[model samples]
Target: MNISRRALCGAAVLAATDLLSFHVLATPSAPKIRVGILKFGTVNWELDTIKHHKFDLANGIDVEIVYFAGEDASNVAMLAGDLDIIVSDWLWVSRQRSQGADLTLAPYSTAVGAIMVKDDASIRAIPDLAGKKIGVTGGSLDKSWLLIQGLARRDHKMDLTRESEIVFGAPPLLSEKAVSGELDAVLNFWHFCARLEANGFRRLVGADDAAKALGASGPVSALGYVFHDKWANENPNVTMGFLQASGAAKKLLAQSDAEWQRLAPIVRAEGRELEVLRDRYRQGIPDRPIAEEEKDAAKLYAILAELGGEKLVGGAPQMAPGTFWALKT
Candidate 1:
C-alpha cells in the first residue's frame, strides 16, 4: 500500500519525537552536591565567592552551599548526609575520621589567626597571658584551640588545658568579651580579629609572628575543602569538577581586587567593619594551592594525635590522591 504525503510526514515526526524521548530517558541528570560552610568567615569567603563561583554551574554539576554557625554544626550536617562536602578546618576532619566518619582533604583555603586583646589591657605577650582569662570557641575541632596550644607550648611549655583559664564561648561573644575587657585575650580568625583591632584591640601575635617564633619558614597555615569519602568516590568527575572550579575561583581572586569588593558583603556581615575586613583580607589570604598545605595538615594531625584526638592518614586519601588539585596540563 502507498502512503499519503501528509501521513508520511506525520509518521516521521512521531518517530523523531520517540527518538528524542529515548535519548532523554537514557541520559542521567547532573548530580547536585551539597556543601556545608561556616557562615561569614574566611571559609565563607572561599565558599560564597570562590567555591560557589567555581562549581555551581560547571560540567553538569551543581554545588549547593549550606552555611552553618560553626564547624560542629557543619560536621553534624555532614554526618546526617545533608552535605556532600565540607570546606572547614582539618582538625575537625581528623576528629570525624577518628570517629569512623570517612572524609578527605580537597584544598587549603587560607592561613590567618590572631591573638587579640583589648587595646587598654596590660597583656602584651604570651607570658603576660598567665592567669588571664582567654576565650575560645569550643567543639568541632577548633583551629583556635590548636593555635593556643601551640603558643602555650612555645612560650611556657605549660599545657593550655591545665595551665590557662580558657573560657569557652561563641565566636561573636568571645570577640565582644575581649573588647569589653571581660575576657583577657581571644584567639580568633581573621574576620573577628580585624573587627577587634579596628575597635582599638591589639593583635599581640598573628600567624606570621607565630610561625616565626616556631622557626617555621612558611606561613602557619590551616586546612580547608573537605569532602565525604563515599560521595567523592562515587562521583569522581563531579568532585574533580568542583575542585577545578574552586582552583579557578582562587585564581580569579588572586588576580583582582574587584572580586574581593563584590564578595565583601557576604564575608563581612555581622557588624564587622568594612575597613577592618579589608585589612584582614590583605594580611593573609591564600589564593592558590601551596605545597605547605599538606605539611600543615600533617602538623594538625600530629597535634590531634598528641591530644589523643585522632589518628592522621599517612598519605592523601585515594579519592584525591594528592593534598590539593592541580590543573591538567
Candidate 2:
C-alpha cells in the first residue's frame, strides 16, 4: 500500500479501538464512580484489589474512593449527592427507606461480630454471660448485641442487657479491654473477633449463630454497597460495572493467597491472625442467590425487630420491599 493509504488505515484502526473500549472514552475524563468508604474499613481491601487488578478499568469505570471516619458520615455524603455509593448494612438501608430514602444494597460481605472470650474464661453459654462484664462494640444498638440478646432470651430466658454489666465502647477499645482482662467477654466486629480467635481468644457466639438461632436459614449479609435506587436506575451500566468489579475483586481475594500477602498491612495482622482474617473474610463472601439472601434478611429483620424492639430496626417494622438490589442478568 502507498504511504498515505497506510497512514489512513492506522488512523482508522485507532479510532475503532477507541470506540470499542469503554475505558477510552471519547471525552477527556475517565468514566469515574465515587464511593464512600470507612477509614481503615475491610472494604478497603476489596477496593485496593480492584485498583491493583485494574478491575474498575476492565469494567469500564474508574473508582474514586472517598473515606469517612464513620458510617453516619458516609451515609450523609451519599444522601447529599457527594458520593455514588457507600458501605452500610441493609437494615440501615431499610431504615432509610422507611424514612423516605430510596437506598438499596448490593452484597459485599456477610461478616459480622462474635462474642469473644479470653482463654481460661469460665463463660461457656448464654446463661454464663449473666452478671459478667461484657464489652459491647458500637453501643446497645449493634446488631450483634441485639441478636445475642435474642439468643439469650430464647435459649436461656434471660435479658443479657439487664443481667450482664454492659460496657459499650469502640471495637478496638473493647478488644483492648478484653485482652487486658478487664472485660469478661467482648462482643466485637468480625475482624476484631478474628484477631481474638487467632490470638487464642475463644468465640462464645457468632453473629451467624445468633442469626441462625433467630430462624435465618444461614448466614445473613451485614454490609454492602448502598446507593440511591434512582441513581442506580439512571446509570445502570455504571452501577452494574462497579458491582461486577467488586465481585471480581472478592473472587481474586478468595482464591489468591498472594493477594492476602499484599493486603497484610491493610488487615493489620501477622502469622495466625492473618490466617484467621483470611478465612473469616472468605467465609463471609455472599454465595447465596439474591432471592434467598433477601428471604433470610427479611426473616432476620422481623425476628430482630420483635426481639430488639424498635432499637435494632428503627421505625421500620419490616424490611422494605426491594431492599436488596439484584444485579441485572
lDDT scores of the candidates, listed in order: 0.59, 0.81
Candidate 2: where is the Cα deviation over 4 Å?
1-29, 327-329
Indicate which candidate wins on lDDT.
2
TM per candidate? 0.70, 0.89
Q: Cα lDDT for residue 75, model 1?
A: 76
* Per-residue accuracy of model 2 over 36-128 as CA lDDT, tens digit each: 998899999989988877777877788999889888888888889899999898889998888888899877788989999977989888799
Q: After best superposition, candidate 1 residue 262: deviation in angstroms?
A: 2.9
Q: Candidate 2's error at 70, in angstroms?
A: 1.7
Model 2 local distance difference test score: 0.81
Best by TM-score: 2
